[model samples]
Target: MATGKTDLGNAFEDFKLGQRLAHATPRTVTAGDVALYNALYGPRFSLFSSDEFARGCGLETAPVDPLIAFHLVFGKTVPDISLNAVANLGYAEGRFLAPLHPGDTLSAASEVIGLKENSNGRTGVVYVRTTGVNQRGVAVLSYVRWVMVRKRDPAAAVGEQSVPTLAPAVPAADLAPPPGLDFRKYDFALAGAPHAYEDYAVGEKIDHVDGMVVEEAEAQMATRLWQNTAKVHFNQFERAQDPSGRRLVYGGVVISTAKALSFNGLQNAGLVLAINGGRHVSPYFAGGTVFAWSQVLDKAELGGPGGAIGALRLRLVATVDRPCADFPDKDEAGAYAPGVILDLDYWAAVPKRG
Candidate 1:
């Protein structure tokens, strides 16, 4: 019998700029997925919750949370894109074009858009735009992300660097609400907040008044649940070589947890339409408690068949072991605070309740 050979993952030199890859597996989102997502993230967005609430808002049934579809698509790219990644540096120009429901089958593909070699010979940044599609072949979500990956050979020749210019934020006019989604009959009581799109003002801030302590099991389980195959997050032997001596918590986990915490004051700010940009400013690990807060940067009325609608550009900041009652954020030098781990900018649709 032949000996089993372990599959070593891709290296920085292996990627060609503009190369396209079709990721394996078409995952079918189930009711169980919806339930587990709610448990993991605690999103109280009524559009993804009660069917009665959804119908009242003009949806046929409750739709799956946008982040669920996001994590699923992002997870599918791990093996091909970030298997040998040192860090997922950032994300940009993400747009949720359509809604997905339980039982919808989603598949994804990615095309390398840019590459840059780091000064250190052993690392480089790989930029790719990934698109997710339902079984019908309609694009559901798309985003650009760049990751720092290791080189198998430190002396490998550096390729021509090409970093794609990305939009500072998705234009509010381009942000699409789900087709057939109408929030005119939105129920404030069921949504757990009375705030409407008109209720918020530009330059306003809100403290997300809750926190969750990171746990090793939950972090590992969550990353794995999305089929994320990053070695640093799983292989203890490999991660032990890092200076931190700890497996870094996934940034998406921080996003989800922070988004969940935002529910306290942003209960009606559901339906994430676009991710303008995001940065994992610092690493987070188990044993750290995470808190978050949001600032309203801008707001716009969206023309939708669903009656009055609006989108808000919100800055979500997450910190470790630090509460955000005062909205702890950046400094004069544009540096994050001591405990700040994430700085995310995004647009979300809030109902103009009838």
Candidate 2:
């Protein structure tokens, strides 16, 4: 079908290896965006929640949560990259390079690094590495994501199969915290967590012990806040053909909600340095309650023995309608529990005891 003037977006067959797409829309971060994000996710990370606390730790003011920046940047790619996508498969090698203040403007661009048609021939996978840059053209965030996209014509022949080899996790040495960041004088009393970097041990599990119900209004509002235009998230008529006959909740919503819920136990580990990898284990819909748990996979000291900051490699899992007291997870064969919806691996900056 010809879209003519209306721009229906690119199909799998329309993409070619090495294609570069400079996505449209540059959005300036704002106080309203920050407030709305906080309202939606209820994140209580002191660094992002209080300007005074941020200044005490050496920032000019509290910065927007890194995930907000991630969502904004990721949302910009949807029109050109995944408007016709069946689903976003996974994310890898994501790094947050800079803090985004309220006034900073963000834009994105992506390079098609790989492509392969599915054996079934109805759809294919597309790999792209996207870079989000601020107004000065400095890259603020970078990540690689693959999506399953529908083909315009099932009979169309795909030229070649190229899959990029991704590192299992970002090396700890490569993680970057903001410049001038010093937790030496960090106020643990005001931060709401007595436990610092020294208190957590590798292999320890922390049940966030909280759950938040996903409401239809808030989920759609969050997707719109990031300017995400994915049809599956909003077009009921388009989704009517599917068995569920409902709009799908955006995966980013689950990530943010689960991260917010983690604050109860991992309050000190607020600043995310890098997302090693993540997967939407299953589809989530509105009206389901989300619960989460975290396990410390690894840890690193950033500056030295006397360094003010450290990093924790964490596995954060979110499950629908299931409390995490039992730590619901994959079995020996790696099958997730029936309620599991998200599994995320990432490195976070935590303040060391000063």
Off by over 4 Å in 1: 1-6, 240-244
TM for every model, in the order presented, reads: 0.96, 0.97
- For all candidates in order, the CA lDDT equals 0.88, 0.91
lDDT string, candidate 1, 273-310, tens digits: 99999999888887789999899999988966655778
Candidate 2, residue 131: how far the Cα is off, in Å: 0.4
RMSD to truth, every model: 1.8, 1.6
Off by over 4 Å in 2: 240-244, 304-306
Residue-wise C-alpha lDDT for candidate 2, range 1-354, written one tens digit per residue: 776789788889989999999999999999999999999999999999899999999889997899999999999999998898878889999999998999999999999999989999988999999999999999899999999888989998887679999999999999989888988988998989789889999999999998999898999999999999988889887641236665788899999999999999988888999999999989888888999999999999998435879999999999999898976488888898789999999999998886
Clashing pairs in 2: none
lDDT value, residue 296 of candidate 1 = 100
Candidate 2 positional error at 210, Å: 0.6
* Candidate 1 lDDT score relative to the true structure: 0.88
